[model samples]
Every structure is written in structure tokens, then in C-alpha cells.
Target: MSKTEAAARLAVRKTYKLYIGGAFPRSESGRSYPVTSSKGEFLANASKASRKDARDAVSAARKAFGGWSGATAYNRGQILYRIAEMLEGRRAQFVAELAEAGTKKAGDVVDAAIDRLVWYAGWSDKITSVAGAANPVAGPYFNISSPEPTGVVAVIAPDEPLLGLVSVIAPVIVTGNTCVVVASERAPLPSITLAEVLATSDLPGGVVNVLTGSVKEIAPWLAAHMDVNAVDLTGVADEDLAITCEQAAAENLKRVLRPAAADWYADPGLKRMTAFLETKTVWHPTGV
Candidate 1:
């Protein structure tokens, strides 16, 4: 066989799909959209998620919340660190994806993303201690407050794609919240590939579901979902769209993280992690 023919035969194209309940499935609507590189070269068809897909993702997240939140914080930390290890092993693939999507600093972005995951992983067991407080009561009572997961969180991934995605998702899940993430519409291939990494990691199924499609089409559904306890709008750049989604989220008084320009490489602080957390205080009698 000719060299050119052999090379062509050796090339394998990948079809990107939505990750729901830890399984890669095509959009329930059977719709997909073309993904292209910065040079306008054809890449692949990415799943164009629909409202039903968003609903399904929420269901999956809700189902996984109990076990994930109830698991030992140390165990959750191990799983998150495992995800970082997996990402490091596949760094080459992520760099390629980011470069194809027009990111100039692909390698740096990949490295920063891996590092961000590690940072959040270390926070898993420490967040409670750092955020929790014990109060001195006027009476003979012990009062202590700690942070707890807010159940299902819906995340809208940012335009920066790789680094932005890692920044938002790591904080939410590290705190034991399950999430349904909407990957950046224009550059979702990397996020889908990240899903592949999560599937192989020690992380539990349905803990992190990813959808690749129009945020306009799916974000509203997730925002309004009764079972979704929080909404992260860090990725929605359109002002009108962001407001609409926030309004929908108010239907259930869901914890809403409004949209804002973020420097993904900078310190994320504890805001993102605390946004999806609820504080629970307990009181015990000292005279027991």
C-alpha cells in the first residue's frame, strides 16, 4: 500500500458525546453540531444537547448527590486527586484540543488546569475546618456550624474553555456537590475529552455530567430545575441571557453564581466553593 493511503487508514476520527450518569450518550434528541478548529478545519460532530438532555443530567446529578455528599471527605479528596493524576497522564491530548480550539497558550492552560484540580483536591477535607465555626453561647450549650453540599449544581463553562472549565468544576465537586456542566458552546471538544478522563477516574458516576451544546437552549432548563440546588453562570457572557437564567433560578431560590469575567489562572479564593455550600448549625446541651 502507498504511504499516503496507509497514513489515511491509520487516522481515527472521534465522535464527541455527552457524559451523563458516567456514560457517553448521544443527545436524546439525536442532534449534533459541527466542531471546527481555529483554521476552520473540520474536527468532529459534538452532541448538541437539548432540554431533555439537561433534565436527564440533572436527574443523574440528583441521584448521585446523597452518596457523594455522605462519603468521607478524605475519600472525596482521593478521588479528586486521582482525577488530577489522570489529567496529567493525558496532558498531551488536552493540549492538542486546546490548540485546535485556537488557544495560543494550550500547554500552559493544561498545566494550570491540572494544578487547579490538585489545589481543589487538597481543599476537600480542609474546607469544613476553614469555613466552619464554633460559637460561644450565652447559655450552657454547644453551637457549631459547618458547610455542607448544596445537592445538584448546574455549571455553565466559560469561553476560555479548558482552564475555565477546570476552575469552576473543581470547586463545586471537591466540596461534595454533584454537577451538570454545560461546556463552552464554541469550544466543547476539550471539555468532552475531559469527560472521558473523569469516566476512567475513581470519581463516582453521575458526580460530574457534561453537556456540549447551546447554553441558550439548555441553561434555562437547568436553572429552573426544581431538583438543581444551585446554578453557576460564570460562562454566560450575554447579559440578557444571564439575567433570564438567573430569574429562572429564582424559581426555587437556587444558589446563583452570577456571570463575571474571571482570570482563570489567578487565585479562585473560596467564593466558588462556598457558593454551592449550605451552612448547618447544631446545638447540643452542655449538661448532658
Candidate 2:
């Protein structure tokens, strides 16, 4: 075969799809936008999620919350570790995406993201111990407090793209909270590819639904969504936009992780996990 024939045979384009309910589907709106590399090279067309798409994602997340939250901590830990393992296997793909998105150290970023997942996987069972406590009261009553998942969460993926995306997502699901994430507007290819990773992993359907589009257009719907339990605005770099979303979240009393500057490569600690948790205290009569 001639070189031209071989090159034509090898050309296979990838169609980026929206991930919802463990299925990859074209956007309900049937809209897509061009994705370009940092040097302005055309990569692919990413699904442009709409308001209805956001609603669908929320519905999927809410539907999955019960089973995910009910699963044993050990089971959740195992699943998270599995995701880390899968990511390890896809290191080359993620590195390529990160490099295309203009990251300087793509390989190091991918390594950090995998380590971040493993770190959070280890914390799956430990968070309860660290965040829960047995309290002493004046009366002869036993009081104990524990943390629980906050149901469906909406996440705005950070602009740092690959590593930032992983940093925000791992902590939420590790504790059994399902999420609908809006990928970085400019660099969404990696996030959708990560969705492909999640779909193949041990994670159940709707545990993590990802949307690719303009955050300005999609974020308000998620923030104000009545069914959504919380909103993580880690990706909203604009203070005004973040404030607007926060106000909308107030309508439903949603747990809001306000926008702030973050170093994605730094140790995230327990803050992200704790943000979407609800503390419940129980008291019982002793010696009735």
C-alpha cells in the first residue's frame, strides 16, 4: 500500500460524547463546539451541554445517590482505588490531553492526579473516624455525631483542567455523593476522556456525570436546581459569576463551595470531602 493509503486507513476520528447514567450520549440539544489545542490546532468537537442536559445529569445523580451512599465504606474505597488503577493504565492518553491543553508538565500532572485518587481512596473509610466524634453531655445520654453524603452535587471543574478536574471529583464520590460536573470550558477534552475512564471502571451509573460546555450558561441551572443538593464552584474563576451562582444555590439551601484560588498540585487535604458532607448527631437514653 502507498503511504497515502496507509495514512487514510489509520485516520479514525473520536466523537466526544456526554456522560450521563453510565451511558455516552450525544447532547440532548445536539450541540457541539470546536475544541482546539493551545497552539490553535483543531482536536475535536465537544458536546455543548444545555439546561435540559444539566437537569438530566442532576436526575441521574439523584437516582444514583441512594445506592452509592448506602454502600459500605470499604466498597466505596475499593471502587475509588479501581478508578486510580484505570487512570494509571490511561496515563498516556491523559498526558497527551493535558499537553494539548497547554500544561507544562503533562506527565507529572497525570502522576499527581493518579496519586490524588489513591489518596482519596484511602480516606474513604477514614473520614468518618476523623470527622465523627463521641460527645460528653451534662446528662447521662450517649451522643455521637457522624458525617453523611449530601446527595447530588454539582461541580464546576477548575480551569487547570486535568489535575484540577481529578482533584475536585475524587473527593466527592469517595464519600458516596454523586455529582454532575461541568468540564473546563476551554479544555474539556480531558474531562470527557476521564468520563470514558469512569464508565469502564467499577463505578456505578450516574456516580459521576460530566458535561462539556460554557460554564456561564450551564452553571446557573445546576446551582439553582432544586434536586441538586450542593454546588462546588472550584472552577469559577470570575468572582462575580461565582457570587451569582451562590445566590441561586441559596434558593434551595444547597451546600456551596465558593470559588477560591487553589494550587491543584498541592495537597488538597480534607477540605473538598468535608465540603459536601452533612454532620448528623444522635442521642440515646442510657439506663432507662
Candidate 3:
């Protein structure tokens, strides 16, 4: 076998693990599902994360939120750029996974996926300056408002696999917010592999966690999760499911982004950044 083929064979046998609190742990439920390669061949077992696993992922995100959000914009930008670099290095793996997933335009999807990461990486620092501004409230006091991270974010990744997953996740983390992502139901193996990329990309543990399982089973828990500050329904295709998730988010006044049927591979501009931000107001008395 060629060196590339040898590496591919070895990766196929690697047992995938869930990243929690910056460490790999077998699912608390001890469950796994079969992962397949591009050729309809079984590759490995992906962790079948349970409710307990979802909750654990949330806890990890919550714990890591402070440090991640508190990081300087420059540092966050660097980390995001690092992820793009890692993704570039592993382009072949993603291409292989996409082929296995049977995408009709695997080449286009791969290009879009890598391109999406780079787009978001550059936005890591610039978003704050663009979306966030010093608001001037008419008063004899110093008033300033700027955008801040919305705590922990829960996202339902797009079912298109490569473009879909990157579109949702890149925006969530670029602004210093951590996320618990549920991968596409039909094609989850790519999401699992992406998680591996993050694990090695210098991202803090829990800053971006991935879970592969039934969204019908886990998404509700996230919507109602008090610790989760926001919800992105970008992946919910069913109208009823979207409605139910919206209702759950309203429970805690969680920020919600309704799903849109956008062509994800097309240019996704500032919309993603504006969707997940919170405005924070700072006030002080001027006539002290």
C-alpha cells in the first residue's frame, strides 16, 4: 500500500472518542454506532452520546465559557485561524469522508468547507468591531454598549454534512462563545472527524464539543437546558420540530435563531455573526 493508503487504513480503525472537559472519555452511557467510509465500507465506531452525555457536554461548555469568552480578541482570532490551518492539513481526510457520504459534488463541498473555516477565522476579531459598537444614549452619563458572547450555544448542524456543519459551527465559536454541536443525522461520520480536528487544533476542551446521535432525542434537552444561553435551529428541517424547539427556548428567554433554507455553500456573510451576539450596556454617573 502507498503511504497515503496506509495512513487511511490506520485512521479507519481508530476508535473515536467524545471530547469532554478537554479530555477524551467513553460515553457515560457506553454506547457507540458504526461509522462508514466513502465507499460504503465500515470504518469505525462513533460514540453514541446519550442524554447524560449531552448534559455532560453542556457542563463542560459552561465551565469553559468564562475563560474562552474572556480571552483577548487577538488570542481568540489566533485559535480560530489555527483551526483553519489544521483543516487545510487534513483536507484529504475530509474529502474522503465526503465521498463516503455520497455527496454528488464532493469536490465543491470540500472547497466550500475549507473556505468557510477561513472566512470565520478572519472574523474572530473583526466581528466585535463591526457588530459591536459604543452606543451613545442621550444622557449626562457615560453609556457604552458592546456585543458579548451569549454563554453556551447549542447548535443543530446542517444535514448536508460538510458545508452544513461548518456553516453553523464556525460562526458559533468565532466570537469566543463555546458550543455543543449535534451532528447531521444522516451523515455523522464527518462531524466526528471534524471533532478530532478540533481536539488537536488548540481549541480549549468543551469550547466546541460534538455529539453524534439522534437530534430528536437530544435537541430538546439542549433547547431547555438552563445553562445553554442560546439555540441555533439551523439544522432542523421539520417545521414541527423547529416549533417545539422554539417553545423550549422561550422557557428561559434563550436567544433563538430560526432555521432558514439558505444555500449554505454560497457566501454566508455577516448574518451568522449578528445572529448569536448579545448587547451589553455599561453605565456610569457623569456628575459624581
User: Of 2 and 3, which scores higher on lDDT?
Assistant: 2
lDDT of 2 by residue, 34-92 (tens): 99999999999999998989999999999999999999999999998998899999999
Specify the highest-TM-score model's number: 1
lDDT of 3 by residue, 52-138 (tens): 988999999999899999988778878877877887888888887788888877878877888888888888778877876676778
Off by over 4 Å in 2: 1-8
Sort every candidate by lDDT, greatest first: 1, 2, 3
Model 1 root-mean-square deviation: 1.6
**lDDT value, residue 185 of candidate 3:** 74
Question: How many clashes show up per model?
Answer: 0, 0, 1
Clashing residue pairs, candidate 3? 38-100
lDDT score of residue 262 within candidate 1: 84
TM-score per prediction, in order, is 0.97, 0.96, 0.90
Give one digit per residue, the lDDT tens place, for model 1 in 1-288. Answer: 666554435677888999999999999999999998999999999999999999999999999999999999999999988999999999999999899999988999999999999999999999999999998989999999999999999999998878999899999999999999999999999999999899998789999999999999888889889999999999988899999999999999999998468888889999999998999999999984
**If both were scored by lDDT, which would come out higher, candidate 1 or candidate 3?**
1
What C-alpha lDDT values do all the predictions have?
Answer: 0.93, 0.92, 0.83
Best to worst by TM-score, what's the order? 1, 2, 3
